[model samples]
Target: MNFKSIITSFSFTIVFAIYTINSQNTIGETEVFTTTNQAVGNITFTDTGDLVYSHHPFFSPENRVMIMDAKTKTSKPFPNKAWNTPRTTDDNYLSNVLGIRNDENGIVWMLDMAQRDHVTPKIVGWNTKTNQLERIYYLPKSVVPKHAQPNDMVVDTKNGYFIIADEGIGNGGDGTNAAFIIVDMKTGKTRRLLEGTRTTLPENTPTVINGKHLAVNGTDLLVGNDGITADANFEYIYYGPLNGTKIYRIKTLDLVNEDFTVTELDGKIETYSEKPNNGGMSIDIAGNIYLTALETNSVAVVLAKDKSVKTMVKDANMVWPDGVSYNHVDGYMYVSAAQVNKGAVFNDGKDLSTKPFYIFRFKPITKGVSFR
Candidate 1:
């Protein structure tokens, strides 16, 4: 795909960096798009190669969701302009969107946290092929606690289920609570698991970015369970806390089985590997897990064959890489640098984010799990 020069000022620097990175064959980083609006939270590419991204509502309240043409690099409100606009009377409008995934079946699944305007949390599915609303599922207050901050999600298209992660940072930014949620797409039934469990909660670890601790109100903001992904075959769901280093997984069958007691499901949980403080993650068809190392501004991979971790790509410009999506058609992994650590929340109430936030792509050795 040809990337447009959204901001020509950085063209020379970006091209030189890409050429330098490509010469090494470690990983080739390319800037696909740039924006001066709200920082990008999460992104996914449709079957037709159109990019869908969420403007994290943590900083701005507009353009909650958007669709960008891969070739022209022009974006517009997704689904429709009405859904993106904020309305007090309309309950169907998107309030705050973060996690998004486009399945192989031409469906774009969006996870709305509803943290803004006190709207109800919801999941909306849009058919990319038909350009129609496929389904909408609302989460009751019983499952979404007032303190919960639902962020990332993984869709199991074959089984009609989605697993979401609640960082539980709470409205006050205290990262003490966390949970794993399972939603049945067919019935719209949702269940919360491992609520406030040791496995789900954040560790007493500080989030250091570029050798500096990220803090708010004189306290380190250690986010809880944030990144999540499923294996290529959907056999197991893997996730880890943003403030923690240990990765965990459980069989999909065990998680979807309503008859299984919490204890039984806990027994099925398996500790996978000890990783760095990370943001988003994606798995390859070979079962290798690609993770964004937030502190180092690099992508790390956990080998499926041996479970050993290795740094795949390191770029100085990938500041606070928050989300990653692997595109099979282009043979590249797309990443968003949200610069959360540089936001007002961490910069003493001053937003230090550089203008024209970036979306980058790099080629991975193996094909992505979603590749067909």
Candidate 2:
């Protein structure tokens, strides 16, 4: 109830000013789409263009997920309050979440890390069109290790699979246990793939934001395999470590095939492109990969053809641009400025983030996969 809403009328002027000040080779006019009192972790849009996002769990928000009215811009607990509320008779609440995606079938899949309560991590898929709970896919401890933090995911409804990026930062880990969890929609079976591999592990480099190395409790923040996404046809899944410089990917067929040995799957992995330390990723119909460049406070893209990386937009206000999602209805890609480096955990217990947190949008080079 304390979340105040501000309706800014001069979005064009603000975006124009930001574009003019930044020296990067920007591609589009970045507009301040909306603001929220809490830090938004990730974003997705319904078929009707309704915005639904997760509250960054690092801040310990009361509500895990929220939906903002497309017209009124009023925010409310998504899928009702009980799903967001925890620690009662109800056992089916979202403990902690970050990754959220709206699929083509009108389903919003939320990746619940369960870090808030130290419970079993799971995926909650809600039918937005029907306003009902569709399914809950639990990742047991056997599959989700103690340090596995399932951050983002790609829902391939056409192929009946959900590939998740498990950033191994949980339970005092320093990215040594990161991996991907592949879920079979039909049988709800899960597999932890590529754990501790070179592909899933962070490089021996620190993530410097604004010229300062990002660390927590005097230890460098080493998050592995953070940003992830699949191609339009679900033929390939692209991903890389948060502190790594190379983007690697493999065929979706190779990732889910049990017959392929770990070494064989690793051999099939290709270094797709180079990227800065990033948080979220979304791909376009033309195979362009939009990445949230954390260090530069800008959005970057990996061109599908040349495999070249280019800066899309840069804004000073876009500190720690965490989650990027493309909304096909609006023809713009939305991003969340998480400002994680300013969180108390990273700054000697001093919360320095300024609010209200913002979600910005810019026109994409081409049409994107609507449900990514």
Candidate 3:
């Protein structure tokens, strides 16, 4: 497996320091930036659009969650004990922020699924500005049925609740129970919604990689879509099961009201799609949906009102986009190439992603609402 044979679509344009690397038999290059290296996990933006994110460090006792200037492109880990409990469910550092978002009040929140085997797996949050930890936003292990894991989340700041999607299968794609949980920011209570919808789904759509269906985990990786955000209007919540083709939504009021059944909530699914994607999902202030789809080898966008889809930028730079952010100050859109599914766990010991998982910001789509 080499570059020329496996990779068919690649970007010829080079605007920044770029290099070519092998990503699963395909040759790809990315916009290079200087930031502390730890496998970058998930990224979000402050109301001003400054870059804030977490990374998976190899040598540190704990992972780093830091802030950066998206423009100058610099980053530093947050002050220790300043961000919040770096611990997990059973009592360990809460590492890996799969999702991050800032609310209207300017609170930066994350749905952190800490590594429990290293400690206990759990979800918790911290206010970015105050650096205060809210330890109670997570669901009790007793509340989860069995072998259930909480992955990513979407905050409903107005209604005071955040919706979490369960991929069931963790990074290993095994033993995770699928379901969604709603956290009532007011009461600090959590409720479960559709968890496995994103996990149990079969790989109905295949990504073109070297003209072969890309496979991760010995089985073509599918199901358990991750990434979510509330509509800018705060009227509806938009989300996707990481691998599922459709983007779904439901009224914020309905999500927090446990009285409504998941089946009833299913009626609101909007099925937004440009193509099948298996990466982080987010929306901008104008309500545009962004997807880092490997299938298209591009970062994609969907208009909220009409469900119109467009490939924002598709060259070599867009490989395996994971998390996306909006820079309000600079007026640009950003995305990452986690090539998450390309890890050996998913790709049968073969890493299918191009080296240097990236972070990129295109000009800007300044028209509508952003769902992030």
Candidate 4:
């Protein structure tokens, strides 16, 4: 059989296997939170247990950020409508937001790509305690290239820093350029590292979603330097490319040190075990990295001690699991399934995404890191 036929058959078999597995397992029950026809780009739980998620700008236009009531399954614009409203010349407006996380200090940090109208990228912090904007740090053009797509972020509140992944393929172009961005929380200083390096850039491999090659407009959708997370002690940052398998990490001190040369920094990078095509990632207090395995529709756990991978959960409804966040209060890892492979971006401009995108959560064996 040809590759296409093999993929089709594999997709069917995987779906059937997931159903069979879910029917047999009772320990991890996946609870789905409906998004009212909006694609959930990323999700984070507030200190009070409310769900705050971003409506992926790739497909939707209203409410770039929202807070959802778990009981009512309803959502409203977070903070206010002014920040989310799209404006051509307003510097304070939120153009596009993807990665978001709630810190222990009652602050929610959001990474705005600022792709719309070619505005500079920025990081916005909202203090949930005060229900107001805490701070906004605009990134310099040197750190965020014109075509850079800042995908995900992890905040180090204790050390006052943020690490972000730039997929580098903005507006649907070829995926070759990519980088790791480090932002100093105190000074608002931003620096780009590993730009276009083999560790940051995607391999010459096609992204297979649901066992089929994800191609749009006669080009395969290859993303780079996407999933990122920080250790519990805030000493190291872990990251991997979306289209690549190997995971890598670097010391936080080396990243922030001005004396470290690029060659020296490159030497400090430690390669971990290979992983499946993954989306968002988070590390627990025990140092285990949780990843959303997009191809197999499961959550994979990578142990810090041995760097070995194991599947935490697999379900039939996990269509293109996009982001994974650990909520300590609930003791579960929340995952957002945007059904990105089924959206218009991959379906030749025909939207195949089902309405009411889902956010699923399941309890992991290990307790999550208490960064907040």
> Of the candidates shown, which would achieve the greatest lDDT relative to the real structure?
2
Ten-residue region with minimum lDDT total, candidate 2:
1-10
lDDT by candidate, in order shown: 0.82, 0.87, 0.57, 0.80
Clashing pairs in 2: 225-241
What's model 1's overall lDDT?
0.82
Score residue 269 of candidate 1 by CA lDDT: 89
Per-model TM values vs. the true structure? 0.90, 0.93, 0.76, 0.89
Q: Is candidate 2 or candidate 3 better by TM-score?
A: 2
Q: Where does candidate 4 have its weakest 10-residue lDDT segment?
A: 19-28
* lDDT tens readout by residue for model 2, 1-372: 222322233553475456545544775668799889999999998888889999999999999999998778999999789898887565599999999999888999999999888767899999998999999999999778888889999998978999998889888889999998999999999999999899999997798987788997778999998998888888888999998999998999889999988898899999888888888898888798999999998999887778888888778889889889887677889999988888998888999999989899987666777777
| lDDT for each residue of candidate 1 in 1-372, tens digit (9 for 90 to 100) | 235655543674575466456735444445545553668888898887878999866677578899988888888999889988778877888888989888888988888898876889999889989999988989888778888888889898877788889998868757676888789988999988888777788888788876789888888888888899998888888998998978999888887889988788788889999888998999888787888889887878887768888777777778888888887667788888888888887888898988678888877646787721
- Candidate 2 error regions (>4 Å): 1-24
How many pairs of residues collide in model 4? Answer: 1
* Selected candidate, larger lDDT, 1 vs 3: 1
Model 3 RMSD in Å is 9.4
Q: Candidate 3 on 311-344: residue-level lDDT in tens? A: 5666564555666666565655666655554555
| RMSD over all Cα atoms, model 2 | 8.0
- Give the backbone clash total of model 3: 40
